[model samples]
Target: MSNGNEAGDRLRVGSAPDSWGVWFPEDDQQTPWQRFLDEVSDAGYRWIELGPYGYLPTDPHRLRDELARRELTLSAGTCFTAFHRGDVWEQTWAHVRQVADLTSALGARHVVVIPEMWRDPASGEQLEDRSLGDGSWRALGTGIDRLAKALHEEYGVHLQFHPHADSHVDTQQHVERFLEMTDPELVTLCLDTGHISYCGGDNLELIRKYPDRIGYLHLKQVDPRVLAEVQEQDLPFGPAVRRGVMCEPPQGTPALEPIIEATRGLDADLFAIVEQDLYPCAPDVPLPIAKRTREFLNRCGAGAR
Candidate 1:
C-alpha cells in the first residue's frame, strides 16, 4: 500500500513538465511548444499533463511525436465544460469520448473532469449556490452516474471528478453526497488539495474514507489566510483562481501530514501531480516548490509499497 523506496522511482514526485498544464492567461509570450518541452525536460520531470491551450497537440501522431522528442510521457489531460447544461449532455459526452480516445492513444490512463459552467437553478447563473436543497445533490448524482457509465462502457476511460471552487461539488458535504450517490466502481474521485481545503474540508479524511475510489490527485497548497479572505468576500471561484490563491504543493499553510498518512494505505494507482496555476511570471518559480514537495514525500517514508 505504500510506495516505499523500491517503488519511489516509479511514483516519484515531479512537476507536470509544462507550463501549459498550469494554464496562465497572462504568460502569453508565444513560446514554441518545443521550447516549453525542453524547459520542462531540463527540470528533472519525465511526465507531463496536457492543457487545452493552443500549445497542446490535438493530432494524436503529433502529440506522441512531440512527447517522444522530449523523452517525456503523457501523464494525464484536463477535460472541462462537461455536463454543464442538461441539453448539452450528449454533446459533452461526445467531446469527452474524443478526449478519452486521445488519452488512450497517447498512453495516458486518467482523464480529469472539471465541471465548471454548470448552472445553479436557484441563482440562474454559472456559479454554484451552496444553499441548494437536497434535490440538487440527487440531480448531480444522476448526471455523474450517467457520465460514469459512459466513460467506462463506451471509452474504457476512468472518470475522475474534481470538486472545484465555485462548482456545485466544491464542499465537503457535496463531496460526501456525491460519493453517496455514485457507484464507486465506475466513478472515481480526484482529490484536489487546494480546492478542498479552500472550501473548508478535511481532504485527508475524504481520501481515507474512499481509498479505492481515488484514481488521480492534484497536489496543491494554499495559504489559509488568503483562503479565509476568499470565503469572507463570497468571491466567485474564477477570481480566486486568478488572484493566485491556489499555488504549488508544499507551500503556503496547509499541513500535508494527514494527506501523507491517508495515502499510505491506498491500493489504487494515484498520480500526485504538482499543479500551480502560476504562469507568465517566471518559469523557474515552480522548481523550489517541486523540490520541497519531493522532500516532504521522502520524509513521509510511506513510499515503500
Candidate 2:
C-alpha cells in the first residue's frame, strides 16, 4: 500500500472472479473453474477474486493446487448472505470461517460481506419491524465487533462491508451511519463505485471522507442514461438490475476521472476489483473491461498510487 508520492505506487488492478468474470450460468458451456482461470489468465490477469458461485475447492490443498496450476493468485472472495436476511448466523459463521481458512490457505486476506435485506420475501415488501436505529446499531456493532475479533484472532483476516443496491446499507448516508456506529478497526468499508453512484451518492466525497476505512473497492461503472431510467421509472433494485442499469468498468455513461482522483493517494491495502454486475448478456466482458480500466487508471496516474 504505497502512496502516490512513493516511487513505486502501482495500483494493482484485477477482476472480481464472480459472475462478472465468467457469466455464471452461461459459463457452463466452458469447463467449470479451470476454463475461467485459463481465460482470465489468457486475458492478462495474474490475480482474480472468487465469487461465491464457482468451482472453488473447499479443501485448502486442492484450492492451492488449482491456483498454482493456473498461476493465479486469489485476491479476494465473497462472503455471501453473511449479513443478509437469513437466519443462519451460526451456519453463516461456520461457512465464513471455512472461507477464512481457505483464504489463509490460498494466501489471501480480504473477505467482502454483502449485507442482507430486511425485507419480506413473499411480496417483496420492505420490512420495517427489524430495522436498525441507534439501539440496533449497538447490537449490530457488538455482533460485528465479536465477529471481527474472531476473524482477526483466529484467521488474521480483514472483514470489508460491501454496501450494495437493495441491501440494508447501500446509500452514502447508510454507509456513513454504519461507519459511525461500527468499530472502525474491526469492520472496514468496501467502497463500491457503481453501487454508490446508483444510490445517487458522490463516490469521490465518500472516499475522501473515509479514506482510512476503505478496506477494498469494487471498481464498477454505470450508464447515466440507465440511471436516469431507473430514477424515472422509480424502479427498485431488482427491476433496475434487470433493466441493465448497472454495468461494467470504464463507464460508458459518467466519466470515471473523479473516482480515480478520489483514490489517487489512498494508502490502505486496496483491491480495486473490477465488478460489472452484468454477466449473462455479456459473456466476454470482464477481460476487456479490466484492460480498459487498468489503462484508464494508469492514464489518470492511478497506478502511481
Candidate 3:
C-alpha cells in the first residue's frame, strides 16, 4: 500500500458544490452562490467541479469573475446524460454542448458524464442489479465513445464516465462490463468513492485494478450505517444522499486512507474532487465539514501541497 501519510507526489485536492448543501434552490432562503465559493476558498481548496449546470453562473465571464475572486479554478463540470439511447442523447447533447463550451472557456479540462435514469428517486427504484440486452450494451459503449471523442476533439475536454449508484453501471460487475465495452483510450473512469461503495463495490480495489483508466475522481465517503439502511430499506438515491450517506472523509466505510493510498502514481493533473451530496440541508452544516475535510486530506498527505 502507498503510505497514507505521504500519498505520492502528484495527487491534488478539489471539491464540488454538493459538498456545500446547495444542490438546487430547495429552500426559500438558500445559501448564496458566493458563500459556497468563499467557503471553498477559505477551506483551502484551489479547484472546484461545477455541480448542476446553472447552479453557478452559466455565463462564462460572470462565472470566471466569481471563481477568480475566490482563487479557485474550474476542475470540471458534471453532465448527467442518458447516453444509452440515441434519441435521448439528441436532446441532451445541447446541454452537454453548453457545458462543454462553458468548461472549455473556463479552462476546465474534464467533462464528467453520468448515465441517467428517468424514474423518480423517491420511487425507491433499485437499479444496481439490472442488466441491459447485448445490443443495448453495445450501443451504450458506442455512445460513450462518440461522446468522449467529440468532447475531447471539439471541446478540448477529456470525457470521464462516472459509474453512479442509480445509473445503469451501478454494481462492480456492471462497472467492469461498461469498461470492457468502451474504448479505454476514449472513455475514462471518473471514480466516485461513495457511490461505488454504496453500490457494494470496493473503491480501493477498483482504483488498484484500473489505475490507468481513472482520469478523475469524486472523493466522497459513504456512511456504513446509512448504506446498510439503504440496502435494508430499499431507499432511493436522493433519500440515501439526504440521509448523510456521503459525508466527510473520516466518517465512512472503505476508510479514505486506503482509498487515497490507492490513487498514487496516476496522472499528475487528476482532480480528486471532494463531493458530499448534501441535499435540503443548512449551509452551516457543510461549512465546518468542508474545512475539516480539506484539513483531513492535508493530514492524510493526499491534498494539493
Candidate 4:
C-alpha cells in the first residue's frame, strides 16, 4: 500500500455487495448473504458495506458476529434519499434511522447516502424530472443539511452523500451544486469513480478541486466501448450494467493508479471501497472479479494494510 506514504496514511480499501451482484434486500436472483460474506472474505477483503440494508443481516449483534467470524469490519451502510421532493423529512428519516442505528451500533462511523434516481434503475421508467427547479434545489440542499445534522447528532455517523447515475446529482456540475447547497461540515462526498465516469464526470478534477469534500471512495471504472454504446442508445443504468458498461479495473477508463495517488496526497485516511455494479449476475461471477480487483488495487498502492 505504499506510494511514498506510511501505512496509516494509505486509503483503507474494501468491497461491497454490489460487487457480488446484489441490488435488493431479498431477491431470488441475488447472492445469499452468508455466501456473500464468505466469498467477499475469500476474495481477500476485510471490510464491507451494508448494501440495500437487509441484503445483510439487520440485527446488529448477528451481523457483528458474522463479520467477526470472518475478520471483516463494517465500512458503512447505504441509504437512499429523495430530498428534492420537499417536505419529506419524517419519511426520509424513518428510512435512514434503521440503517443509521445499525451502522452506529456496529461502530461504523459513516452512512453512505445515495440520492434517489430520477428514473427507476431497474425498468428505466421515468419517475421524476431529470432537472431540478430552483425551489426543488433549495429543498434538496436544506433537506440534506437537516438529514446530515440529525444523523450526526443522533447516531454519531457522518453522512457521505453519493451522487448516482440517473439521479439529479450525477454530473460534475450537479455534484458541485450539491456540495455548495449543503453544509460542508455536515455533508461529505462519497466520490464513486464508476458512477462519476458513467455520468461523464472527471474523477481526478473533482478530487483535486474539492479534496476536503472527498470523504470516501468507490473504486470503479467504465468500459469506453460499452459506455459509448449505452450513451448513443440512451440505455438505462440497469441495461448499461448488464451490457458490461462497468468493467473491472485496468480494463476501463480513468486508471485508478492516479486516483489512488491523488487521494494519498489529500493526507487524510479514507476508505477506498471497490464496487462494480453487476446486479443479477451469476453467483459464480463476483468472487473471481473481486480477487482480481483486490490485487489490482494492491498494485495501484491501495491494498489492505
- Best-matching candidate per TM-score: 4
> How high is the CA lDDT of each candidate model?
0.65, 0.66, 0.80, 0.90
Among these predictions, the greatest lDDT belongs to: 4
Q: How far out, in Å, is residue 189 in model 2?
A: 0.8
Question: How much is the lDDT of residue 276 in candidate 4?
Answer: 96
Clashes of each: 8, 3, 0, 0
Tell me which residue pairs clash in candidate 3: none
lDDT-wise, the better of 3 and 4 is: 4
Residue-level lDDT of model 1, residues 188-262, one tens digit each, is: 887887778888887777877877777777767776666778778776555665566776545664565556556
Q: Which ranges of candidate 2 are over 4 A from the true structure?
A: 1-10, 19-31, 81-88, 118-135, 252-254, 302-305
Write the number of the candidate with greater lDDT, choosing between 1 and 2: 2
Stretch of 10 with least lDDT, candidate 4: 1-10
TM-score of each: 0.82, 0.82, 0.92, 0.97
What order do candidates take by lDDT, descending? 4, 3, 2, 1
When 2 and 4 are scored with TM-score, the better candidate is: 4
- Model 3 Cα shift for residue 165 (angstroms): 1.0
- Top-down TM-score ranking: 4, 3, 2, 1
lDDT of 2 by residue, 1-305 (tens): 22242212434556655534343323453235665666666655566776763356667788778778777788776775533333446876887787787777788888887776554322336655435656555656566666777788898888888887766676788888888877887889888888888877777787788888888877777788888998787666655655677665455534465665566567764666667665343556555655666666556545522
